[model samples]
Target chain A: MEAKLLLQDHIAKTASITDEQFDYVYSHFKPLFFKKGQTIIISGDKVDCEYFVVSGCLKAFFINDEIKMYILQFAMPTWWTSDYSALYNQTKATINIDCITDAEVLCLSNDDREKLCKEFHQVEHFFRWRTNKGYIASQKRLLSFMNNNVKIRYEELLALYPQLYNLVPKHLIAAYLGVSRETLSRLYASH
Target chain B: MEAKLLLQDHIAKTASITDEQFDYVYSHFKPLFFKKGQTIIISGDKVDCEYFVVSGCLKAFFINDEIKMYILQFAMPTWWTSDYSALYNQTKATINIDCITDAEVLCLSNDDREKLCKEFHQVEHFFRWRTNKGYIASQKRLLSFMNNNVKIRYEELLALYPQLYNLVPKHLIAAYLGVSRETLSRLYASH
Candidate 1:
């Protein structure tokens, strides 16, 4: 699907906007593509733009003090990803985002998002609705982590991203579930 | 402090609104009070309104399949609490919210929030900014959990809610840290 159409479809679900308004809104986004293993944002760098995944997969991950990698999220088509804490606060990124596969994304800068929200009421509503969903998903993720049930976590991950098994490597999925690769393999075999 | 004043001040930081608009927005919120240990939202019930704390503390929590308690968030004064997933999706609550101390809150129904956002662009902007902060906080919380260091989690919790130590009970804090009471006590003594 075209990036514009994907984004338009996403925004339309929450807020009503005319064709001209959508064109104006879409103009603020810059299309970018990355090959597999390409880093989009890295820890210690300043983050300005957030990506809307148009194709392929990307992982938002963090490295702990011990240098252990933890996958925070996987961005698939129509999903958004960013080191948002760094973007909103103008702080250095504490997380990294990279392509899991060759990916195309629409990048929207912080300034352009704010401008669009100010310019269009529907845009503001769409953003609010978008963030609400993100917050809820994050909260659910937190709850699952606190529960510390790896099997349930594995199931939830598959449910969230059904295409993930084929698209994402087992080790990456293990990192996302906070389980060992062997454990993920066991879970995979069981499923 | 008055609920309206607290809310108006909070909104002012993110958005600009006329006094008339502020008053109109304020009218939608209904003030309610709860005693210490009172339940506001119970798991399995329909969730409608989200509570903005005027005074005292509240906990948003979950009881796992094993019936173990996990604290998701502490809603202090000026903080909002709700089973947001349920409220947004119109599903039965999967988490419960309760007053940790005698508390006052201004409740805003989901319908009224939508109405307010539609009526005022600034209100919409305020909510978008509000949810953006929430999404960031939730993401940070998830990251901290993924890091899985109790000592660091304890420090971060204190840093987030400085007055929480004097106000909240120790066991609840332990629950938030996903640690046992003894471990929290050891961390407390070490600090």
Candidate 2:
């Protein structure tokens, strides 16, 4: 699918806009490609753009002092990814975003998004719903983590990203679940 | 401060509106009062509104199968709280909201909020930035949970809610930090 159509379709789910308006919105996005294992945004870097995934997968993650990584989000097709804290607050990124698979993404700069939102009510509506959905998902994830039920968490993970098991490597999935590779293997075997 | 003025000031931080426009926006919010320990929305109820805190505090929380409770957020002055997943997706609430102290709040029904957003571009912009800030806060909380540093998490909690220590009881503070009363005591001693 064309990246522009993909974004237009995603935006259409939340807000209605004419073809001409979509074209104007699409013009603000710059397309970018990355190879598998490539870093998109690194910790401490200044982040100014948020990416809309068109193909493949990306992970936003953090590494603690012990050097253990925790996956924050897996951005698949139509999913957005960024060190949003850094992007929105104009601060150094505390998390890194990198490609889990060779990827194509449409990048929208912070300035362009604000400009587009100011220019079009529907565009503003689309972004508001986008963040609302994101906030809900983050809260859900937080609840699951607080509950500390691995089985339930695994099921919720699969329900959120059914394609994840096939598209992502086992170790990466383990990182996302915050489980040991051995524990993930046990869960996999049981499944 | 008057509840209307409080809301007006909060909205003015992110948006510009005339007195007439502010009056129109203020009309959408219904004032509500609750005593300490009063429930606002319980688990499994249909959630139709989100609250803006004018005075006192509220907690959004969940109880697991073992009946252990986990605090998701504490909504203080100028903060908003709802079972956002249920509110946005029109699902049954999975979390409960209740007052920590006798409280005054301005409630905005979901439909009214959406209507206001459609009627005013600045309202849409205000809500987009509102959710943007919320998403960032939720993401930060999730990261803190994943890192599992009790001292750091305690410090972050304090920084996020400075008045909480004096207002909320010790046990509820422990619940928010996901620590035991004894551990909270140790941390307090160390502090």
Candidate 3:
């Protein structure tokens, strides 16, 4: 499916929008491509756009303690990823986004999103609803991390992403699960 | 401030509302109270509603494999707390929300919240936007846990809540930081 069709499907799931409304929404997002290992946004730089991933994968990572690197997000197809606070707050980015595979994405600049919001009421509401869903999912995952067992969490990951094991690297998945690489390997072996 | 006034201020900050709309929105939430240590929602229990903190505090926690408690959220004044998936998905709750202090809250049944959404366009949009913010912050924190050092995380928490130390217990704060209580104590003392 084309990107617009996916965007429309996402909108229809939440709220109704006319063809004109969809046009206004589409106008703002510029299509872009990135090669693997491309840095979409580097830490300490201003981030004015949020990328909507149409294809391929990306990872958000940052340096810690002068010796270690930590992965924050692994953006899969259909997922939106960015230094969100930096984009919203218009501050220097705190995280770096790197394409893990060659990618096709819709880049929605903060300026264009704001303009669309002002020009179209549905656009504003559409984004609001989108953000809310994200928030709910975020809270759920955080709570699960604190509450659920590793085995349970692993099961959830499988349920949520039936093909995730093959799509992403095991070590990165381990980092996302907040487990040691060895533990993840053992979990994989046990299964 | 009175709970109604607080609710009004919170709503007005995001979107302009008619006085009638305000009253309509307020009426959907019925005031409820809970004493300290009360279990608001238990694991394996049905979750039919969500609570908005009008006064006091609560912690949402669950038991891990080692029979240790891991806190997912510390809901203070003006915050909304619940096992939202159980409430939204009509599933059994995985976490228990317990009062950390004598609490007063505005309770909204899932049915009532849906009705509110159907009746008022703005209310639905407002909540959606709030949800997005929540999602962003949650994912950001999850990433921080994956990437940032405990010191950086603690410092960010301090900046976010300058007086939270005095307001909340250190153990819960440590849990929120994804750190051990002993580590938090050392970090606090060093700072």
Q: Candidate 2 on B64-138: residue-level lDDT in tens?
A: 998988899999999999999999999999999999999999999999999999999999999999999999999
| Location of the lowest summed lDDT over 10 successive residues in candidate 2 chain A | A147-156
Query: Which segments of model 1 are wrong by more than 4 Å?
Result: none
The sequence of per-residue lDDT tens digits that candidate 2 reaches over residues A1-191 is 99988998899999999999999999999999999999999999999999999999999999998899999999999999899999999999999999999999999999999999999999999999999989999999999999998888898999999999898999999999999999999999999
Using lDDT, give the best candidate's number.
Answer: 2
**TM-score per model for chain B alone?**
0.98, 0.99, 0.93
- List clashing residue pairs in candidate 2: none
Task: Tell me the interface RMSD of model 3, in angstroms.
Answer: 2.8
lDDT of 1 by residue, A1-191 (tens): 89999999999999999999999999999999999999999999999999999999999999898988999999999899999999999999999999999999999999999889888898989999889989999999999999999999998998999999888888999999998899888887898
lDDT-best of 2 and 3: 2
Residue B8, model 1: Cα distance from true site in angstroms: 1.5
* C-alpha lDDT of all candidate models, in order: 0.93, 0.95, 0.78
TM-score of 3: 0.88
TM-score of each model, paired residue for residue: 0.98, 0.99, 0.88
Question: What proportion of the true contacts does each candidate reproduce?
Answer: 0.95, 0.93, 0.72
RMSD of each: 0.9, 0.7, 2.7
